[model samples]
Target: MSPRLVLVGPPGAGKSSVGRRLARHLGVELRDTDADIERTAGKSITDIFIDDGEPAFRELERAAVAAALAEHEGVLALGGGAVGHAETRAALRGHTVVFLDVGLADAVGRVGLNRDRPLLLDSPRAQLKRLLDERRPLYEEVASVTVVTTGRSIDEVVQEVILHV
Candidate 1:
């Protein structure tokens, strides 16, 4: 069977970091939609949003996410906002999705205020809280398994994800 897994969470929940390690442990390719979009656009996500606006960037992200699902069999780390797309969320149903849950403090610590993350443009603590509040329900609704990621080593999280997968 195809080893298809999706990692869902807000920024700084270690989706990309854990994803690479998980893919390594699982012996599958790691396909990160953010990286894919960056490569496709020939620019960073921040640049995409600045030049083309958020709606345009979302369009690009949606397309890249769908393409990754179609073309790859590996751990897929989506951008923090990718789950906001109803169609993409629908497509994720019945697949193995693990929500790497992180509180505002942890997320803020993991990602400083001056990062390239578009959504994290404001005060990181408040912004992270807002984002977590906004995306929390959506993540839970779509996830087959939820893993609390704060204070845990990457190996621990990877083990949990492997268990769920």
Candidate 2:
């Protein structure tokens, strides 16, 4: 069977960019769970966060992640917080999950105080670290492999995932 790979990481950890390139290299379609959630919700994710609460947005994300896992056999890039939900984390069992581990500084540099990220809204760098600290264990729990992306180019990260996955 062609390998089905799931890329998980904090926001700005290169999941979407790496996933797209990796999928291209592997000749498989790339399914981004965040985009799936946005489409399913019939609104942009930022809009959902503004109108509905975080809980509601999470529910939508959870649904989208579950659906993508169940139906898609290609590469998938999950939103950073997808693993924080127990049900979603549990669903990852037996699937090959690659954690693109980027440090707080690199992540902040990649994300750049983008308030569009629902969870990071108004939070400082310390808050980003705290969030990563909180979710790190969960990501570790489900990840079949962890690839650090700090100080690495997108090609380097994709090569690492390609070799590992």
Candidate 3:
């Protein structure tokens, strides 16, 4: 079992939204690793971060990604930082990974002071920018195709992704 499509991007890059629509369009289920981690851990991601710290959360995320990649024959959406793990990046080989590229302005606008995002607790704009900058290469490295979601509608992005798949 494996994903028909895998979406990767920073927060506010529309991974969840696009993943849902894409999966529906493709007549498949959407499995988000973040959601998976939360389900398995029986806690929210923010709480996991607070209680277990980033490293622990990342470990859970890695395992979740591996499980989803191996077991889910549907659409999969990964947390923004999942690409930071070298093992995850290597594991992405031969998968149909899409990088949902979003600009800082669009990202900030979408995420805007959202407290639930554990990484964006301080100066969301700056933090988002840094995340985008730091993770763009990793996203690119793992992606088979890239879709810019900066000003595009979900439909538009989904259509483009469909073309790639």
Separate clash counts for every candidate: 0, 0, 0
- TM-score each candidate: 0.96, 0.95, 0.99
Q: Name the lDDT value of residue 113 in candidate 2.
A: 79
| lDDT, candidate 3, 3-91, per-residue tens | 99899999999999999999899999999999999999999999999999999999999999999999999999999999999999999
Q: Each prediction's Cα lDDT score?
A: 0.89, 0.89, 0.96
Ranking by lDDT: 3, 2, 1
Q: Given candidate 3, what's the lDDT at residue 161?
A: 95
State the lDDT at 79 in candidate 2. 94
- Report the C-alpha displacement of residue 29, candidate 1, in angstroms: 0.8
lDDT of 1 by residue, 63-118 (tens): 98788777888889999999989988988877889999997778888998756998
Output the worst ten-in-a-row residue range by lDDT, candidate 3.
1-10
Ranking by TM-score: 3, 1, 2
Better of 1 and 2 by TM-score: 1
As a TM-score, model 2 comes out at 0.95
> Model 2, range 1-165, lDDT digits (tens) per residue?
323899999987999999999999989999998899888889888889899988999999899888888889899999999998999998998899999999989999998878678677776577789888998998999999999999999999999888887
Off by over 4 Å in 2: 1-3
Relative to the true structure, candidate 1 reaches a TM of 0.96
**Among all candidates shown, the one with the greatest lDDT:** 3
